[model samples]
Target: MDTAERTLIDPTHFREVMGHYPTGVAVVTGVVDGEPVGMVVGTFSSVSMDPPLVAFMPQVGSRTWDRLTLAPALCVNVLAHDQLELCRTMAVPRPDKFDGVDWVPSTLGAPVLTDAVAHVHCRQQSVVEAGDHWIVLCAVEGMEVTRPATPLLFFQGGYGGFSPAGMAAKADAELITAVRLGDRARPQVERLASRLECEAAALVAISPDELTTAVSAYGGSATMVEPLGQRVPLIPPIGEAYVAGAAPEVVERWLAKVGPNEPGLVECYRSRLAAVAERGVALSMVGPGARSDYQRLHEALAEYASGELTPARERAVRTVLAQTRHFFDELDVLPDETYDVGAVVVPVHGPDGRVAMVLRITQLPAGMPGRVVNGWIEELRTAAGCVERDLVGRGAQQASDYRDWWEADFPM
Candidate 1:
């Protein structure tokens, strides 16, 4: 080291800035002296492929690292998003951390966690002395992705799972456009939510099969908050308003997912879309008897939001949603009839009259009169009209341009 190169860096500032880079979470476990030993590490990474090598940096004075050094081999269990508690248990400094933990011995004689996304069995190959840490290199013996789920991550002193921003059918620039449109609707959404005493949100079709919440506002007793980028499935009965004016092929592809178990439901949903197109707004209600069905719909939507479902799981989720079709039953809105409003949906259109975005209101006061719910629908429609006019002022979202962008990024 050159004397001129010596520089003093503030430890707190260094840690603060470096914390911005997220790292994968893993628990290194090994059996030593007939006892299981484990410690959580956010510094796990592969260092070489030619020699099948990996490395993790442990604090220089870490007692857990010191204890694990005696083991013949160690296994790195990549934690899944749902294993934060498990990670905390392994991270604690204790002698009986593995008690009641489900695990088995790996091929390299190291403890492999049962529900980890992956297990990498390795033996220590080199211990490089680094300032304030030990760069423990390992010769990879075997590795396999076991559970294959979204891995847990550490960022800015907190834990969160990966939400793929690129999971949409549009590119970053187009997504920025969507956000801009959402910004145009933000004020209106907030105002409508306040006036209606409910939740209001702007949703954009990121893909044919999914729509992400671009903006949201809550008022009154509405406590539900939709994350700005939370994606919801576009299956039947869920997003009819978003696609009532869509191209025939787009609507057809959406309807085909209605499932075959109930043959009559195909036309029923088809009529629902037609009604949405005619009324220019979608209306649904949850009666006292149907509240359980409404909760089931919400649960199914939450599962779809995870974006981690396998084909079988996705099919199962779709079935759950399809079975809730009775919740979206047609409403004639008799003025004197009392209704428990479920949601109000209206569309924001492009220049060519294509359905581009949707405004939805949910979590409303139950047991409202049909006339009151009708007034709420009018408010949502007016807000959607304002956003549409604002979008026109920007001269953006021309159907040709939007279609080109969508097709270029993701084939329809």
Candidate 2:
């Protein structure tokens, strides 16, 4: 059978068939005449990672696509679930699409939707004409993620989610910050926030109104508070600092100056809370270490919340929780080994043209608090050059030195 003839399905019938597949909504934006312009698309997708690239299909008849061609670059904004109306409005060919939307232009003159779940600003790399659409491709040159949250999806003939609990990938650096918070120093949380340059404004994971109300009590202002979703805080400059790879000294200094008691950290949190007021999602981890930690906690919570925590798993979790709680209760009396025993992992590039471990510290059977104090001595030995010392001997001293460095750099 000829292809067209054999598959002569009616257009109305095909709508029912095609509507089963779910797709995400995104907006392709760029600047024209110094004013921002954009059109929403349901087909935007990431195409490559090594040399970052993305692709989207724009209807051949779209005027927004036509205007987009004039710009040398463009930005793709991934809409969140709450942005359904925003997507619907931009999807149509509106003369002033930015009427109710907020955005800013990028270095390449692309319109980037403010605080999209994720956005990529890129320069036009190439384009190809498909049957009824144009395949727009671009090479990513710059990007910024305001926060980590669920992406809005569109599929079939209606809007929906592929999975019951939508999932997303988060930045790795943010995950580290969330793990640090597991230390449960909530009493001095404001102080922790200062040391970290950010604090998590969280509420009981329940209803939106309740969450925000609780958050407000904790000195956090709530905005677009979702009933059941992870809403991370946005700590600027500090959050952006992580992405820029700021110097350790700068980060440490900032950490030292900000904290619960300090006006600077408190002001930073309050300022962000006020900015996001009643918008999309409230209760962000603003400031101290906003960017990364906010992302990590959101992802972890989203993942855990979406799935049913089995009784066995719940029991195990509770056990760990209790253990951690007990550790904190007796934190002062805890043996040095109990407090410090792990290696501080850092990502670095080495002489082999690949990343290699530069240093590590381990606890010893000996009762010496030497892990932090003597650890520095061993590190100095390496300063001269690689000293061929046994793991046991080096770990005891180096581990202590590592603690000292951390204390000096980010004293609690």
Candidate 3:
């Protein structure tokens, strides 16, 4: 665009357009008057390599910069994903921003924020005027990566983290390949089912509102509930575990199909989700006088599966499902309590920390001991962990292969 056309763009439009590009978060810290002083900046960048130069832009009127620039040296602390509060603390105008923060003096007497992903100590090199900002350049004297955690990212006016897109794509591809090759978690599900003496199923979510049973195993004396390849709506009793950690939009989409639209119902669902997060499991226990309710639920599920449920029956089934959606949500809260009957579902997380699959055991025998139930829950968690580890390992290997190919094709 020409200079006149660029000048025509408003500040809001300029910010919005530039915000599309993600930036790493950092806090520029220095000692002023023998006290620690810092300010957060999103424009920190490496300027030159041979000269070991770094640069950051601060608003022309920024008092923090006016004071920080007086210092002989500065330290750029790269923030981690967990250091968002610290970033905010440094951004706002405060007299004692480092009162509660932990840090140590760098070699050049600049404050180095603790727990940062990395830190670069630099000496003031030069400064230049850039429109309404001052571009301050520095000569890097020392640098060190303090941690291996993900760096905090600022994108489109929000804070987030990054996952290797190549790795994520490969992970999804591998999962789909496994499904196409009929390499389900059948062995793991069957072993757990036999050990727990219950009906166990491995379910993969095809969408926010749909899950397909990849594998199912029924114990010799257990009742068969769902079969392999059975596609079911992501509703309660069987699907809440999968929905608990899903994105807010996905949760809303699934909840729109199920009722409890009232504020109280929303709170209940939120509580249930919190419970699931705390317990790492979702439960559906058949309390006293609830056998008939479960029988109706089973009938409703079967009809839904067969596509034979009338519209009225479908609504009724959904109502029932919503009522029991949070049945196990409180199990973790009341861990000391014993339930007469119920099922337990646990989610296995992939490398991206998303629910890759769900392991479910249904139809627990009544009057089962709480100790045994706890043991079963632990075993389920262990099995889920194993699946997660295997998937992560595979994804890592795939990422390595891609890196090798890229390096060979485009040497740097």
| Best candidate (score: TM-score) | 1
Runs in model 1 deviating more than 4 A are: 1-114, 117-175, 260-262, 395-403
lDDT winner, 1 or 2: 1
For residues 111-173, what per-residue lDDT tens digits would candidate 2 score against the true structure? 778767788888888889986788888899987766455567777667753222112223333
lDDT, each prediction: 0.83, 0.45, 0.74
Model 2: worst 10 consecutive residues (lDDT sum): 205-214
Ranking by TM-score: 1, 3, 2
Of the candidates shown, which would achieve the greatest lDDT relative to the real structure? 1
TM-score of each model, in listed order: 0.63, 0.43, 0.50
Q: Which window of ten consecutive residues has the lowest lDDT sum in model 3? A: 165-174
Candidate 3, 169-280: lDDT as tens digits: 1224433533432234567788888887889887765444556677778886896667665557666545778878766765666555544456676666667776786778
Q: Against the correct fold, how does model 2 do in TM-score?
A: 0.43
Q: What's the residue-level lDDT of 248 in candidate 1?
A: 87
Clashes of 1: 0
Q: Report the alpha-carbon TM-score of model 3 versus the true structure.
A: 0.50
